[model samples]
Target chain A: MTDVLSGLEAGFAVALLPLNLALVMGGCFVGTLIGALPGIGPINGVAILLPIAYGLGLPPESALILLAGIYYGAEYGGRISSILLNVPGDAGAVMTTLDGNPMAKRGEAGRALSLSAVASFCGGTAAVILMTLFGPLLASFAVKFNPSNYVALMVFAFASLASLVGKNPIKTLLGAVIGLMLATIGIDANTGVARYDFGVPDLLAGIDFLVVVIGLFGMAELIHLVEQQVTGKFTILPIGKSFVSMADLMATKWTILRSSLIGFFIGVLPGTGASVASAVAYGTEKRLASDGDTFGTGNPKGLAAPEAANNAAAGGAMVPMLTLGIPGSGTTAILLGALLLFNVTPGPMMFQTRPEIAWGLIASMYIGNVALLVINLPLVGLFARMLTIPQRYLIPLIAVLAFIGVYSVVGNPFDLFMIIGLGIFGWVLRKLHFSLAPIILGFVLGGLFEDNLRRALSISGGDWSILVADANSLVLYTLALLVVAVPLVLSRRKRMALDTEA
Target chain B: MADRIFSGLLLLVSIGYGVMAFTVIKAPFQYDPLGPESWPRILSVVSALCCLGLLARPDTERLDLTGKTSTRLVVLLVLLAAYAALFEPLGFVIATLLFCAVLARILGATMGHAMIFGVATGILGFGVGAMILELNLPAGPLRALM
Candidate 1:
């Protein structure tokens, strides 16, 4: 109890610093704008910012403060276009607009936007408090772990992520293994021998993370854009009311609490992400509504539930990130990497070594959430007006920001090339049925897997038995096996059923 | 080959890696014998087997490739490679401007409009990165101002 209070106190003190607050505000504002735009999402946005952060030399805590705002605020910002434009920014915001846009079309846009704001705050605030309470307990347990178990833990992480997505499991594994292989490129850290650099002088330093991120997300996305010759023009938004009335709030109080609980729990689970949380929340609300038939048709309660759930989930997803160092989504994965750059190793030790960062970040989130609600309500009119801007001018400026941000941080010409390369690749991946989540899961966990495997082996004199001998390690390993085989079992049963049908 | 694409990619990569893993003679140990490469390899092999299983009974969920999308992808890749090659020689502001402008045009922006954006982006980018972020951009001919 004392520990929790002290951490909270420390978080507040550290977060109050002027530099950190500026970063939090800047990140939130920028993140909201990007999220409001069509075709750009959080992963690409974060990847684009990576080089800038590296080049700027911002303190890790401040950097994280900014990135966290970008993440959570983007989760909040998607509600803008989703409510008015009838276009979902990402897969997650698809639900918010079902009724949100209809209400907008009916001139109840202000009411819908206001409900979204309050619901987002309720969900965001509740989850942040829950994270503050539970995250430390998880971290404390993680701190006691032996290095041998980290290998098993990494395996468990990969297996759980691999099981959830709906693609050919084999191909996903291939991409993940390739990521692991890429991570091992350059000189072998243990033996001091180069493994895969192919001996180029520059290659000796290993493949750069900036290079990989830009290539995967930036260049990939560009490719898709060029192929389609994409053109999206924004319409000017008329000023609308932005406050939810007292009567509406009183009517929806119970619905908000129920969905917030549902959203937070699901959000904490790895691989669930915001899309699922919103979908489940909508379904639950629809089932639980008294006059449920009006959903998808301009009802205020319709817009509120999914909006609340997704925001709530955004806050809840931080649990795995802060406590276990296992990120739940692409945005959180980027946040995890940013933390690593700060030398803030997550898990149990994070709370012990950098309670200021752990709690300060949590405290900043509390402040950041309030800032979003206050900032977004009045500003929504101005932002919605941005929809009227001409595309030629806006896209070029966005592109310029990306190039400048990338080049400055990496200080390598190659980094810009990588960004363009990956942007195009990302574009193609989006066009195809492939999910970027699996690839990221593969890439992030790849390093942890290899490092632990080598570390575990060196301890046990090359005998593999140590993996099974450790009790905790064994349980995690069993979980990994079950995760892999369960899908196979279900698929086989489905195949047999199909055969009978034939 | 289609079935083997996933399985074969894995099997082939694994063989190459397994052979390569031996180059370290003694194969240094960590706290255990697995070291850094062990678990990655174990996963590689297991996932490879899963691919093999899928290949043996290939399901017909074929992905259709559009010519324009594939062509766009190739163009994007080539353009980036070119940008990397020209970076040091062209310098920061010039290279980034040209790259951004060229990319915007290729991604479907009109040339005049694209160039205007490209130039604005290049200047503002250098300003923000250099002045505000305090990140050092390549100086080259711009060094006199510096």
Candidate 2:
């Protein structure tokens, strides 16, 4: 307890720095704007700003604080479009639209916005508290893991992603495999042999993660927006009152608490993200609540459940990234890439080596969440108005930012074309109903996965049995198997039950 | 139809990768039991299997790649490619101006509005990138004038 308190105190010392505090507020503001813009999600927002953040030369902790602020802020801001425009700002906000848009239609837009903000605060704060207590304990356990154990852990990560990420496991798995293959397109550091470089000098350094992110999320998102312009129309609701009654708060108090708990735990699970968290929480509430039929009819509890869960999940996803060096969500993968850029390897050792960076980020999230609640409640009108911004203006800015982000970071004209190519590929993949997150996770984990696998084999002198010899690895492998098997079993039983009913 | 074609392409790529993994990837000396080739070989086999699964059970979905959409997309892509080609020689501000203006015009903005937005975004973006970020975005011919 003392250790946590002291560490938190130390973290506050860093997070409370004038510059860091400014960054948190600034990031939250920008994040909210991005989140309010439909078709631009947190991933695109972060990917676009990442290079600029790095170029600004902020300290690692400060940059993390800013980025973390953007992350949680986007979670908060995603509700804006869902409520007023009936369009989700991000995938995590999809559930919010069910009840939120109905509420807006009923002229409760203000009440819904304020209530969801409060719910977000409760969820985000609650998740941070849980993360503070659980993160260190998990790291302490993970620190004991050996090379073989880590290889098993990586397997567990991949298995969870393939089974949990998208509608089709095969598509998800293929996406991951493609990502891993892309990660191999450079010189092999260990053997000093190039594989698939095609004799290009620019290929020697491997494909930059920034290029991939901007290409897939930023540039591709612009292309998606262009399509949206053809298919969809924008009509935003007038925000009504901007205030919630005390009775409304009392009605949703328990829903917020329960969804926060649900969201936090799901977030801690590998491969799942806010989309899953919000869906599960909303579904659970709908099933458990007596007024379940009122769920899609603008029920305040329905709105609160997903709003709380997604914010809580955002905080929850940080635990694994901080402790085990594995990203719990797509956004965290970008964060992991950012840490690597700053030469800060996040793992169990991060606590001992750079407590400030780790704890400071946690501390800043608390403040950022609060800052978002305050900023969102008052300026939501401004943000909601942003929904009126035309595609012509918005699309151009995204294109320009993508170009600047790539050129500033990689400084190669070839990467400029590379992003455009990747953007097209990403658009085609999205059209095929293939989730892109698995590819990112696979890419980010590819090096670590191969490194640990080879090390384990080397230590065992080519005997693969060492992977199964240790209890930790055995446990991890079993967990991996269970993660894949349980879903298949449950679905099969569901089918059988339906057949019997038929 | 798109899924089938994409999967077939993926299969071909995987086969090519597997062949290269075996034939091209060689270590001067063995540093570990599992060499660089082993990982790629594993990935290629898995990828090939997954691609086969996708091909066998291709998603029965249709894409709306209408003539208009395709024309706009191709023009946008060409404009983007040209932006890259011109980024070094034309400089950030001018290149971004032309790109954004043409893009805006394509997306249904008036020519005047597109030009105005292009100038505002280009000059403003360059200002922030150069002055605030301290990044060395190429100034090109403008450098001699400055």
Q: Backbone clashes per model, in order?
A: 44, 0
Indicate the TM-score of model 2. 0.98
- lDDT per residue, candidate 1, A157-234, as tens digits? 667667755466655555556566667667666666566666666667666666666567655554444443446554
By TM-score, how accurate is candidate 1? 0.88
- Model 1 spans with C-alpha error above 4 angstroms: A166-168, A232-239, A386-399, A419-431, A458-465, A468-471, A474-502, B1-15, B22-32, B35-37, B53-79, B103-112
- Top DockQ: which candidate number? 2
Stretches of candidate 2 above 4 Å error?
A231-233
lDDT of 2 by residue, A335-375 (tens): 88899889898998888789999999988987888888888
Model 2 docking grade: medium
Distance (Å) between predicted and true CA of A200, model 1?
2.8
User: TM-score for chain A of every candidate model?
Assistant: 0.90, 0.98
Model 1, span B10-110: residue lDDT tens: 57767667655644423444344444445545655665675567568554344455786677657656766766666567766787788778877866678
DockQ of 2: 0.78
Worst 10 residues of 2 chain A by lDDT: A226-235
Q: Which candidate tops lDDT?
A: 2
TM-score each candidate: 0.88, 0.98
